[model samples]
Each structure stands twice: as C-alpha cells, then as structure tokens.
Target: MPPKPGVIPLGPLRLGDIFNGAFATVGRHAKQLFGVGAAVYGGALAVVAATIAIAYAATADHLDRIFALSGDEDPRSEDWVPLLVAFCAIVLVCLVAAAISTAMMYAAVPVVLQEAVLGRPTTFSAVWQRAWTRVPAVIGTVFLTWVIAMVPILLAWAGVVALVIGVVSMDGGDGVSVTLVVIGILGALATAPLAVWLWVKFSLAPSAVVFENQGPVAALRRSSLLVRGDWWRIFGISLLAGAVAGTASYLIQLPFSFIGMFSGALGSANLSDDPNPTSVIVAMSGYALAMVIGQLVSQLIVATFPPLVTGLLYVDRRIRTEDLGPVLAEAAAVPPQYTG
Candidate 1:
C-alpha cells in the first residue's frame, strides 16, 4: 500500500488523530519504549543527584577557603587554592555528565519511536547504536531550536524588565509606577504570539534531524515547511501533550509536599532547639524517593507523546508532499490483537 494523494483532513479531527496515534503506538510498544525511556531518565537523575552531592560535600571546605581568602584565616594558605581548584574540577565533571545524559535521552527518542512505528522490537543497544551516529546532527538541531526559541523570549523578557524598571524608578508617586506596570504588561502580552510562533516552528526539528537525517539548517527548514498552514493544529497537539505531562508531574509531587509539611511539623515539635541530622536525612530520603518516581513517570509520559506526534507529522508530510499514505499503511503493522 501507498499513500493516496488527496487533501488530508487537518482540522479539529487532527488533534484526535494525533492523540489516538500516540495512545495506539505506546500501547503496542510500551515495554520497549518505556524501558529505554526509563533507563535514560534514571541515569540522568543519578547524574543530577551525584552533582548535588558533590557540590554539597565541597560546601564546607569551599566556604572555609572563601573565609581564608578574606583574611579571617591565612591569605597565604596553600590548601585554599587546591580546594578551590578541586571544586571547579568537580563542577566541570558534573557538567559533562549532565551533557552526556541529555544527549543519550533525546537521541534515544528517534531510535525507539521509529522502531515502534516500524513494528519492530527495540533493543536498548539498538537505541544507543542508532543514536550514536546521529548524535552530532541531533545536538546541532536541538541547539539551533534553542537559539530560535530564545529570540522572542529574550525580546519579551527585555520588554517586561524594562517596563518594570521604568515603573519602579519613576519619579512620580505610586500612581506613576502603577501606570508603567500596566504599560509593560500590555507590551509583553503583545509579544506573546511571536514567542509562541518560534517555539512551535522549531519544535519538530529533532524529529526532522533524527528520522530524516537532515542537516541542521535543512532540518529546521523542513520543520518550518511541515508546520506551514498547520501551526494551529500543531500548537493544539503540543499544548495538549504539555498539559498532560505537567498535570502528571504536579500530582506526583503532591505526596512529597505533604510529607515535607508533616516532617516540618514533627521537627518543630520534637527538635525545636536543634534540628537532628538524622531527621534531616530522613526527610531528604523521602524527597529523593518522590523525585525518582516523578522523574520515571514524567519521562515515560513525555517521551510517548512527542515521538507519536512526530510520526504522525512525518506521515502527514509524506502524504502531502509525496503521496505516502498507502506506503505508510502497508509499513505500519497493526497486530491482530492490538490492544493499543
């Protein structure tokens, strides 16, 4: 089968189609995709935790050295320099670890998702393998998207900040500042659409680069072209996906908040004179557990939606530009017992 050439319906129906496509795809390939997504998220979270631990461990020594430098201790102390150097070195290592984690997680997006679309079992090794060669392109595409998205945000932020400053520094009484605040708010509101437009335009670049092997500029161009006349629908789908992910994260965090509140109450009652270290560790342990759970669930849900939408967008583009519907239908293997 191949895609039939005709006008593809991309109105209210499109959002439903995209959501259904994601649900079906994830339902069918939940194990493989979820596994890979989980591992990446866990690995990344570990890196973050390690970084925090390292920084915290250095805090006492670093603060001491700062005091030493300020002449409270020995200014000529040789230990201070080495301690500061070590602190900087650890920070650099943490940064590199974080970079590696981000690269692995996003690069895995295409490999696993595409395998699901092709009705193949995705191996963890296969994800690494497929993503390795595409790493540079993927990184570049994402970096470019960041730059593009920042333009409007930067502009809007500048306008808002200027407005705020102007209002705060105004020579008039309270009424003048109020007037300036209102004007700034209006200016920021006016720039909101451009911010949104840039965001949606480059949103699909990673998909273009990974699945299409497009060069950085070409990927962005392709994304722009694919999004043309489709921004509203794309925006709706993206917003829906974001809403789902955000709600899930918030719900997941609620338990930790409750635990923290109870612990604070307990500490205030029992350890009012001096908070116990054991108590602190116990509270932190609960927070850490909650964080891990949230990361796992949030990553799974977030990963599911984008690749699904990207696949749909890919199919849509092929149908429009190359009449690829029938080919996609044949290529898509819907198992007889498909529960997704």
Candidate 2:
C-alpha cells in the first residue's frame, strides 16, 4: 500500500526506520552524492592543511621554543603572542572549511534525497550552483554553532581539571585512591546527561542551517522542533550512524595504525632506555603518521554519512508536512532545489 501524502509521521520516529532509511538512501544515491561529498572533503581538507601549514610557518619559532629545543632561541619571552595569533588564524580557517563543506553537503542532500525517493541520477552541477547562493546561510549557522559549542566544551574541560585536582589533593593512604576514583566516576556520570542532550540538540543543526538559511539560534530552534518528542529515536539513530561510520573508519585506517605501532615499537627499541635524536625522530614520524591517518579516516567518515541522513530527514519532513509525492515525482525527473 502506498503511504498517503502528509500522513507519514516524521517526528516521534523509530530508530530502526531512520537507520535503515539512511543506509538505503546511501545505497540508492551512492555515485553522485559520494562524488560531491568526496570533492567537498578533499577541498576542505586541503584548505585546512594549508591553514595549518601557514600557522606553523607563522609561529615556527614559538613552536620551537614551546618544544624546548635547545638552540639559539628567541630572546623575547612574549613569543606566546605569535602562537596565540597563529592559533586564532588556524581556527578561522577551520571555520571557513566547515562552512564550505556544510554548504556542499546541503546541496548534495536534496539531490540524494530526490534520487533515493525516485531512483535516478541528479545533476551535480545544478545542485552545486544552487548551493552557492546558500553559502551565507551556511556560514551563519556554522558561526553560531561554533560559538555555542565552545561554551560546553570549555566547561567540560574545566570540570575535568577540577576533578583531577580534587583527586590528586586527597590523601593517598589506605583506599583513598579508590574514593577519588569513585568521585571521578560520579563527575563523569554527571556530565554524561549534558553531553547527550547537547548531542541531540545539535545533531540536526546542520540540516536546519542548510535548509532554512537561518542564523544559529534559529537553526537550533528548528532542530529542536524537528527533534521534539523523538529525542531517543534521534539519539538511537545517531548511535547507529556513528557505530557504522566508526567501524568503517577503523577498518580503513587499521593498516596505517598497525604501521605506526610497528614503527613506534622500533623507535622505543632505539631509545635504549634513554631517548636520543634518532629515537625522537622515529617516534615523531610514527606519531605524525598516526595523526595523518586519523585525519584521513575522519574526513572519509564525515563525507560518507552526514549527507545521507540529512537527505533522508529532509524527505521525511516533506512527507510529513507537504504533499511530497508530486514534488518527489518532479524531483525524480528534475532535481529538487534545496529550499533551505
């Protein structure tokens, strides 16, 4: 039986449905969506790498001093100012990368969703052309989210530090460590609920930003509305998405990690119970390889999943609100324009 227009419930959704739908959508529109996603990921990564390289070049002296390299260091103690400026510069670059990626994903979602609903190829260029206009909205949403997310992260870090200090300052005698461990566990428990809430709230923010051309607060509000009365469903779906993506990422990066671990072990052997320059270089090389592998995995995972779910949700919302059957039919022949 065909589902009636505006009768399908989007909110208070089932976790299994969302997860299965996301996967099905990905399978259905794998080629074009994946192509665009990969392009976005590549572009964003290149920009981010360039930004980091610029930052490193700008503050090489400060970084060298921070590492305590024994050489003719800068005489000024205020080299930290350069480091701070470089950090900010890198952050700004990251923000720009995020906004660009989000915009591309926004464009990709409508195309993927349309294709999934009515099995066909979408014009990548047209989708991208429309997406360019929505860049301002995407940037605004990213900016707002960036500002809001920092608050909780900072608070969480501060709490962690306080917990560590509290544990260390306690008496070390006779099961005191156990007591402190319990307290630390309790603190983590306290933070877990906040983390979960934040996750649900912001999970759909990207969609809102992409679709609504909204500022951060408005985008968050829209997400909250969409997610209302269905937090567990969204949360469960999120966990499933994360698990699948994480497994895929781990599998992809496993070889790299193994190589890094092997090199690290070799480096440790070279230490001879005393670190030397060769050992340091070997260790740093392994560490750098691990980091590079991690970044690659992260990019691949991000490129793979977010668009799938966002596209599905956009369709789900349309099915719930508008008479999406005809729209989707038209979208089948002509790719749907991202209304947001």
Candidate 3:
C-alpha cells in the first residue's frame, strides 16, 4: 500500500478496491453525480416528450382521418404520409437526445472520478462544465463502442429471424432457409467473443477522453494499451458491475411499475361504459406518467454507476501500468484552495 488519501488506496487496486472505490465515489460525490445525471436525463426526457407532443399535434388531422376510415376503406397517401413523417422526426429527435445524454453521463463520471481518486471535492457546476466540454469526444467513443458491440447482437438477431423463417418454411420444404439459419447461428457465435473482447478493450476510451484530454481515436488507443494485458480482469469487473447496476435499477423501478399498474387498473374500473376518448386519455395519463418516472430513475442508475466503475478501473489501470499512484498521491497532499 502506498497511501490512503481517497476512495481507493493510492496504489494498484484489487477487485474489492475497485468496487469499494466506486461505491465510495458515489457516496462522497452523490450530489454532483446524481445531480448532473438527473439534469441531463430529465432534460432529455422533457425534450423527447416535447417532440412527441409536437409530432402528435402536427399529425392530429392525419391520425383522425385514419381512425375514421371504415373496415373496407383504405387511407390515402396524404393521410398516412404526415403521420410517417412525424414518426420519423420524433425518432430522430429521440436518438439525438439519447446520444447526448449518454455522452454527458459518460463524461461526467470521469470528471467526478478525477477528483474522487485524489480525495477532493467537486461541485455540480464544475462537473457539468468539464463534462459538457468533453461530450463530443465521449459521444464519438460511445458511438464507436456501440457499433462494435452491435455486430454480434445483430448477428444473433439475424439467426433468430432465420430460425423463425426456417420453421415457417418447413411446411414448404425449403432447405435454403435451414442452411441460412445454420450459417447465421455460426456467424453469430464466431463474432460474439470478438465483440466482447473489443468492448472490454475500448471500455476506458470515454475516461481517457476526459482524463487525458485526448481525441476519440487517441482515447481508444490509450484504452487498448491500458487494457491489453488485463483483458479478463477488466471484462469480469465490467460484467459484474453491469449485473449489479441492472438488478439495482430493476429493483428501484419496481415500485413505480406497481404504482402505475394499480393506478391504471383503478382508473379503468372507475370509467363509465360510455367513457369518451378524453376520459380514457385522462385515465391512462397517471399510468403513463408513473412509467415515465420509473424509466427515468432506471436510466439514471444504469447511466451513473457503471460509468463510475469503469472510470475507477481506468484509474486502477493507470496506477498499475504507468505508476500513476505517486502522482495522484502528490496531488492529494496539496490543499484544495491553494491548488486551485
């Protein structure tokens, strides 16, 4: 052990040290971490809600026309086109909001960790400002990593689709579908390990982008260098962190889900036989709001804790490989105001 200045010992860390440090980082800086997360994600939800509302308003006439069509009647292109355009616009806005929110959280975690590792306090504004500046680079890293991970996931889904097609075609005696299914399954299996390996290898890129002030590609290379010899360790730790975060998120959201379910049931029970559309909408609004709040809370946990774990892993990797412990120790010895 070198020194105990902060969340973790100022030395190469073990598994316990990394997890403890992650939890400690949250405990010490909950205000900054959760505050930024809430603001970013909450703002994203608000933006998405606004987009959906605007889209609905713009296409209200088209929707009404479509709904009014009789069983034998088909909607005109004009009736459907506006709805389709609005749907696409809403999807585009949602994707942009999700990407930006994810980037902010990724950047914010490392910004907090940078000080947490040195036993220093950070404020929400400081974290937000630092994270906002790094969002573009973090977005690049996150997008690249998502693309890399999606390869095998898409392959697996293709396999499932092929399997379904093969089963459907069995009645028609098509051997080609069977062959396609086999090939898809094999391809997915072959690519799955490579995807996992690449994911772990580049897991630290977002942290590197923030901590080292590196570009996305440079941060990726830096992460690969740091994770090269310790792939299994990092993979296992990341897997565990993801499991913990997912389980905790699910538990946290359960209450809201139950509340939504019960409220929706109650509202439905209270509805008259001839309830109007407006009455139905009002009845379901409570359920929709509850579910939205639950999802927001779930997303908050999923976005925050895993990044904190990964950020600390980034620090642990540096201390282990580059002897960064002494440098961090030295920084920790300085008084905060004087250093600032």
Which candidate gets the maximum TM-score versus the true structure?
3
Clashes in model 3: which pairs?
none
Instruction: Supply the global lDDT for candidate 1.
Output: 0.64
| Candidate 2 lDDT trough over 10 residues, lowest sum | 4-13
Pick by lDDT: 1 or 2, better one: 1
Off by over 4 Å in 1: 1-14, 61-103, 156-182, 255-272, 276-283, 327-340
What's the lDDT for candidate 3?
A: 0.88
Expressed as tens digits, the lDDT of each residue in 28-47 for candidate 2 is 66666666767777788788
List the global CA lDDT of all models: 0.64, 0.63, 0.88
Cα-based RMSD of the predictions, in order?
6.6, 6.6, 3.4
* Model 2 deviation from the true structure expressed as Cα RMSD, one decimal place: 6.6
TM-score ranking of the models: 3, 1, 2
Q: Candidate 2: which stretches are off by over 4 Å?
A: 3-17, 51-88, 142-195, 198-202, 208-218, 261-294, 321-340
Flag clash pairs in model 1.
Answer: 1-326, 1-327, 2-326, 2-327, 3-324, 3-325, 3-326, 3-327
lDDT of 3 at 230: 92
* Regions of model 3 farther than 4 Å from truth: 151-173, 270-279, 337-340
For candidate 1, give the lDDT of residue 261.
60
| Ten contiguous residues with the weakest lDDT in model 3 | 331-340
| lDDT, ranked from best to worst | 3, 1, 2
